[model samples]
Target: FLIDCFVFFQTFFSSQKKMSTTSTGSRLYESSKAVDEYIQMHYAPQDQLFPYDDQYAPSAGFQFVARTATLCVESFDKFGEIREGETLSALDVGCAVGGSSFELAKKFATVDGFDFSEAFVKTAKKMQLEKKLTYSSLQFGETFEDRVVSLPESLNTEGINFFWGDACSLSANENVSKKGYDVVHASNLLCRLPKPKQFLKDCGEWVVKPGGLLVLVSPYSWLEDYTAKEDWVMGLEGPFEALKAELSEKFELVDRKPFPFLIREHARKFQYGVSDATVWKKKCT
Candidate 1:
């Protein structure tokens, strides 16, 4: 039954893609204010930030945060147990709205968060500095509702920094290339890049330290607008084998599992899917 549902969705989505032909390249988030706003509202919602009268909007915020927190811990534990008082650093590549990054900051001493969208990074920075930011969600076609999003007043911002960056072109970014972190977390970012293979190789070589951990999660939703068909890692083979092939030389796969997440489009509609998560320990060079 589940397989049948999956097949139906694939066919429906593929037809939709065919019907909506915008261009050959992915619509970069930098150009889309609506996309950035939607991402912020989707990932970084806290119930306390919204008014009691509008509680319906933030219905999934707690669940999103809880799942992100679990992924952070699982990413760290899959590598090894951390000793008490031991300082560690993490690099959250493609950390949209800083949900997972904030979760990582709680576990590690330092976390550097990066996203390609200027709007997302700016909003994340504002939230870190001010503890709150206002975002909006679509109420109906051509209509939107305003809401405030906040982080725990207790969340430590001293250990976290949000930056705008491209994961595929990490070498040019001094902060990510020079500062090797104990863990590099790339969540739902692989299939979105135009050159995912290069990003995977560059991340293994520069971002993660020797004997460190690399955690990747993706839905394999490869769209021609986001990535060219030839550039996709999931082709004749599946995402598992494709990732293993890309990271095999410098990293060893430790665990593979399914990660479920929910994205609320509006009060009445929600999108839920499971992302394939793979954890790898960087091998000693």
Candidate 2:
């Protein structure tokens, strides 16, 4: 029964990211099978935290699982932490697979996460409830290798809840509140939205509370498949300038830095890149 469940989860998760981009409901990473496979192989827990076994050696996947969160955490450290006595509340938008959300839960009293992909959201919910995940990775053309990932028991996960919703349409989500979160985070998600500008505009207006932290990180990998050329904030011209133009009215830029991460496709194959991150604090109105 467990094996059947794993097989079904694998197929469902894999197929979710394999659909056409023209669909209004399709998301960027959620519409790419390769990304789904990559997140499953890496972000899902392993038997051990660090220094994985031989088969999983070169566990560069940790960059996505922990390191991405580390970047956000470090940004907070350099900028600020939650208020001295107040409870922390955060929203992790575009929280693919929930790694960043889990990390945020370590600091916040409660962290709510949302993703456009139902498959990813379901897996994240299971990880929170069952504390374990079982899946297989593609070995070669027809070969597959099974693996099980266990969530760390020490992590305080009672405060994490994940849902399926559009980051671009957060105002419409009944579960999310406008200007309610102490920290609003979106890592590597800017370029993925169909209307990146609209997301930025909406975020500035209603998503983040006044005097809260708003962290935005992205590699600026704008693709026509995911976002239209006219809607891009980062085109051949550049990224940061236009991004500032969008958020400066409501958010003051505090820090701009580079966050490097790695994703492993197999033992021998990997992709490494640095994401441009900007830390913004919503102005007190």
Candidate 3:
């Protein structure tokens, strides 16, 4: 049953790629507006996200980042793969503003947060150095409010290293070249790459060590501006099917589920999205 469906979707989406040209992706993370919005989404309390009523929002602002890392610990424990004294390390690909990296640091022994946007990387490093950042966010039309984003208490940020990097060409990164991680986490980043297929091919093949895990979260929202339709990992069959096709060579699926999240654009307006999160264990050769 699943085989026939995947074939149909693959064929359908392949043809659709030829007909579509415009993309819905916005690659403006380098902009000041994008930086501020991410800052608020990463560090702001529930009240700022839902100014009218904090209780109305789901319990997942920066919590989504925390949950993504926890999924790794849970998976290892489920499989009895948790080493008692092994020094675990993690790589956070496309770690915008360092929310997910900081969250990973709480659990992993060391974490490397990598992103393409210099602005986002700089801000994340700044937060690590200064422990806080002040930014302005749009309330309605022109009204902007100044807010401060502080690092969460009790997190030892000493082991975290932030880097400006391109996801598609990760080999250029010095740390990635030195050694692979015990786990690699990439959230809401697949469909945005200019060449997502390359990233899928490299997940366990290069970045993750043998018997390690690769955690991915994505809404599968493909945009031609960011990625050519021909390069989308999720075709008509959706991300997981196409993802399995690419990753089956070196990885096997361990767990998958919906990971819902919210991002604040302004006091009144917010962007709500549900990303599918999946965990894969690299095959031991």
lDDT measured at residue 130 in model 3 versus the true structure, 0 to 100:
86
On lDDT, the leading prediction is 3
Task: Estimate, for each residue in 99-181, the C-alpha lDDT of model 3 and write its tens digit.
Answer: 77887787777898878777778898999988899988678777888988788667799999988777788877776645687
State model 3's lDDT: 0.72
The local lDDT score (0 to 100) that residue 166 gets in candidate 1 is 75
> Ten-residue segment with the worst summed lDDT in candidate 3?
1-10
TM-score of each: 0.79, 0.80, 0.85
Off by over 4 Å in 3: 1-27, 58-62, 79-85
**1-285 per-residue lDDT for model 2 (tens digits):** 000001124445465644422233333344344334634544655433233566855444345546656655666666655667778788888776676788888877789988776656777788888777666555445455666766689988998888877776777898786547777888777877777787788778877777777888788877676678998896355788889988999999998877665554544455666778788988888
Give per-candidate clash totals.
Answer: 1, 0, 0
Q: Candidate 1, residues 1-285: lDDT per residue as tens digits? A: 000000113344434432211123333243333333444444544442343465455343335534654665776776654545657888888776676777788788888988776656776687789887676555556566666666789888898988878788888887774857788887777877878898888877877777788878777878676678999998457778877888999998887877765555545565667878788888877
At residue 202, candidate 3 shows an lDDT of 74
Record all residue pairs in model 2 with backbone atoms less than 3 Å apart, i.e. clashing.
none
- Which of the two, 1 or 2, has more TM-score? 2
The lDDT of each candidate is 0.66, 0.67, 0.72
